[model samples]
Target chain A: GAGVSQSPRYKVAKRGQDVALRCDPISGHVSLFWYQQALGQGPEFLTYFQNEAQLDKSGLPSDRFFAERPEGSVSTLKIQRTQQEDSAVYLCASSLVATYNEQFFGPGTRLTVL
Target chain B: AQSVTQPDIHITVSEGASLELRCNYSYGATPYLFWYVQSPGQGLQLLLKYFSGDTLVQGIKGFEAEFKRSQSSFNLRKPSVHWSDAAEYFCAVIEYGNKLVFGAGTILRVKS
Candidate 1:
């Protein structure tokens, strides 16, 4: 079986540019999550989705951040007007249930804003 | 605010030696605890989880974790570590909203 997969394994964006990171969750995974990891630090929760519903976005840092899982199988995290502080590895994870299950992860997308 | 703490930032042990990584968490209720491993440039891999009904839960790759409700801890341990086991380990607790709050991670360095 395939695991979660993310696109643009590495992305470099100029300051004030916009960037979008994509995540393809495992088949039938009802719960999806996004996290951000700064250098030398642990990952921090960003947002969560249950199927097509964006249930939790509290961890989103600011108004520039947005996420969507329109079809429940795939999700995207978009950062508008990216800043240098937004530079980090964007990680995506999925689980069989909506929550409290073993999460399967994807190879993250490393975003660098210069 | 809920938080998890991995006391050891790094640990070095000889191959085949037993290992323990301490983790403490702060939450309001019975929390869902988890341990995950991540290799360099890779995403997190679930090692094990403690949902209920068993203080000691076994996980993949010869890893296990013991959850102590009184101590507010879920420490991960492996009896005999292999060189390949060297990686970053994280302890996390599930928040009420179903999102995970991770610890500062412990880096394991195995010396053969």
Candidate 2:
């Protein structure tokens, strides 16, 4: 079975540029999540989606960070007007259900804002 | 707010030696705990999880963790660690519905 996968394993963008990171969760996964991991730090929650609905975006650091998961499978994390502080690895995870289930993670997209 | 704490920044142990990594979490309710391992250029892998059981949970690749409610700790242990076991370990707690709160992580250095 294919695990969660993210596209553009690496990305380089200039400050103020817009970037979109894509994630394809396992088939039939009902829950999807996005996290940001800074250098030498643990992953921090960014957003979450249950099926096609956006459930939580509280962890998003700023308004520039946006996410969408329409049709309940592929999710995208878009950062508008990228900043140097946005340079980090963006991780995506998916689970069979919304509670108590182990989340399968993707290799993550490393975004370096120069 | 809920939080997790990994007290050790890094630990170096010889191969075949016993290893223990401490993790403590702060949450009001009964919590769901998880241990994840991340290698360089790799995604996080689930090591194990504790969700109301016998307190001792066994996981993949010769790993186990004991959850102590009284002490608010879930410490991971391995009797003998291999060189391949060297990686960053994160302790996380599921809170506010389904989001995970992760610790700072502890890096393990295995010396052969």
Candidate 3:
């Protein structure tokens, strides 16, 4: 793809439900990132991947949030037992490489937990 | 720990007027700074970045930002504002291992 692509542009889940969001990064990109953006706030870092290796998970908010980039290209973010506080826009970004390169973002998935 | 601060939560500017958005950062070493713009229902687009070299870096949409080491500030500016420029702007600092630490965004409202 010419740019990063994300699926399920919008999702509504009830409390205690599990939801998954997917991301397809730009071809040949070596770095991928996930972020969460709350209403009227800046995007916060969630996790990072260098190819298929999950190098950084320090920013994940809680145990309910898990992300995986199995093939180094496509990634998935799964939230278990979703809470109302989990409602936010999940963003995916990719860069040519991890160092100093500008990241390209995808139209995020807006998840509303009820 | 690296962090960014955007003091103004909202800014309103008339079309054709000059605009400036303030940003400050706290980091131990030389910081890699970036500015991004996000429109309604859209993804974030990088406006400009400051890694090294000249303090003033030019970006797309007639935007520019100056990185000052002493004050730990990287303020974004545009000579003239346009209605199309209404959007949320974010300031971020690249942390160790290429992580991005972002500040609370500043929403810009352009009046025509």
Question: Under CAPRI classification, how is model 2 graded?
Answer: high
Candidates, ranked, DockQ: 2, 3, 1
Report how far off residue B23 is in candidate 3 (Å).
Answer: 0.3
Quality of candidate 1's docking, in CAPRI categories?
Answer: medium
lDDT of 1 by residue, B1-112 (tens): 8999999999999999999999999987889999999999999999999989989999999999999999999999999999999999999988874788999899999999
TM values, all candidates? 0.97, 0.99, 0.98
Model 1 alpha-carbon miss at residue A55, Å? 1.1
lDDT of 3 at A45: 89
Calculate the i-RMS of every candidate, to one decimal place. 1.2, 0.8, 1.1
Candidate 3 backbone collisions, by pair: none
Candidate 1: where are CA atoms >4 Å away? none
Q: Is candidate 2 or candidate 3 better by TM-score?
A: 2
Residue A106 shift from truth in candidate 3, angstroms: 0.7
Give me the runs in candidate 3 sitting further than 4 Å from their true place.
none
Sort by lDDT, best first: what order?
Answer: 2, 3, 1
User: What alpha-carbon RMSD in Å does predicted model 2 have with respect to the real structure?
Assistant: 0.6
**Which of the two, 1 or 3, has more lDDT?**
3
Per-residue lDDT of candidate 2, residues B1-52 (tens digit): 8899999999999999999999999988889999999999999999999888
Where model 2 places Cα greater than 4 Å from the true spot, the runs are none
Best by TM-score: 2
> Per-residue alpha-carbon lDDT of model 3 for B51-83, expressed as tens digits?
999999999999999999999999999999999
